[model samples]
Target: MDKNNLTPVEKNKSPLILSIVVGIVLILFLAGGLAYAFSTNLITMPFNKAIELLVPEISATANPDSSSIVTITNPNSTGTIYYTIDGSDPLTNSLKYETPITINSTTTLKATVIDEKDNKSDISTQQFTIMEKTVEKAVETVVPENSSSIIIPEEYQGTWHSIKATGTYNFSGNTYTYSSGGNVHSGTIGKIEPYGNSSTILVFYPIEVNHGFTVDPGEKGDGMIKIDGTTYAVENSDVFD
Candidate 1:
């Protein structure tokens, strides 16, 4: 009577033999977890998944055109390229933008991704400019050939520091004011009597200093120089004879 109570019919057969050893250890742990989930295809077992994750697209280039060189392609998923150079939105130190970005003026571009379940994308963008557009050329002033005797444009004769009106000129006497010389401005000059060609005061200052244009001079003189009606000419006097 003291074997305590191991006598309830042997304690109901010891819990029915421990419920058949926990049902055979839960069927060998569900058949060893479905045979390690079908011999390991790397487990996504709920259905099936994986169809193009993403992370691979960037480009740029340059030379005198400032600079830029960002490239990435065919990347399936392995992020580490957050950028923002005016087109904000990319935080994680935000300058992990790799490249040779050397632009001079306007710029705005962005790209971000972190994927791998840590997922953080959605900031991709593109804009560009690196300052290098030079095309300004239309300066062709070349009329030099001054000998000082006054007459000009015989393709112009040398010793030109001459600039009329503003740099103020007096010609012939060596009182050419405009200090800085060379091409148009800072005191540019050229006015061999073109005050709107003012009727030439009706010539004859010795043919207005030797045929200063607009003259017929003689022998039926068809050379012509009409004023009020405006007409000018000079076909002789060897231009400065």
Candidate 2:
């Protein structure tokens, strides 16, 4: 074989060399494609599972005053809280908890936690019982002189019940009875002081049997009477009568 001319054996070796080079190039291309897919997280085979989302924590309380608001919280979980008041499970499209939820009546609350990745947590449920504040008339009592400076309104001279089961308040003449949670607190109206132009404060003192106890009926708001921490609203009156 001449220096410039390849022998038959040498010609065959050239094809082999080219074949090896092509195989190596193909392998490199396949490797690069796999790396790209892995970097982009497009390949599902490498990951066994995704990180699970944390379940939401819920807190709520029933209010006796019928003005109680519920506060739902999710601790250690960073995400939006979805809730439902109808006792159904919470969904992504459910009402979002932007502020504390104000429930005017009895309700069964459900909530769920959703993370930024759209992972949902287990559902949480809670029930709150609200008492119906109904006003009923109690047996009447005679008014005592010098007990109060203001004339007792007939609208207030009745028995009242808190809708939330907070308790009951009976206003008859110069005395009133407030019972709650199996505990009774009775007092006599010492005086009726002016509050706002539309409301008054019913100053009360414990009876002789329970003397030394001071009971202050805070400023009456609207048509509701508040004794201590409990609030009582008059039930519906006889419309026909």
Top model number, lDDT: 2
lDDT value, candidate 1, whole model? 0.47
lDDT of 2: 0.67
Report the C-alpha displacement of residue 53, candidate 1, in angstroms.
14
Question: TM-score for every candidate vs. truth?
Answer: 0.29, 0.41
What count of clashes does model 2 give? 7
Model 2: per-residue lDDT, tens digit, 11-62?
A: 7898899999999999999999999987787885745345466666766555
Measured with C-alpha atoms, the lDDT of residue 58 in candidate 1 is 64
Task: Per model, state how many residue pairs clash.
Answer: 7, 7
Worst 10 residues of 1 by lDDT: 161-170
Q: What is candidate 1's lDDT per residue for 1-241, written digit by digit as tens?
A: 5657577897688789999999999999998988898679655655545443464366776555566655544355466666777877876777775554554566776767654455565666777766667876534333223323344322122222211211211123311222234433121222234323343332212221233322222222433333223432332323223
Q: Each prediction's Cα lDDT score?
A: 0.47, 0.67
Clash pairs (backbone) in predicted model 1? 145-156, 145-157, 145-158, 146-157, 146-158, 163-189, 214-233
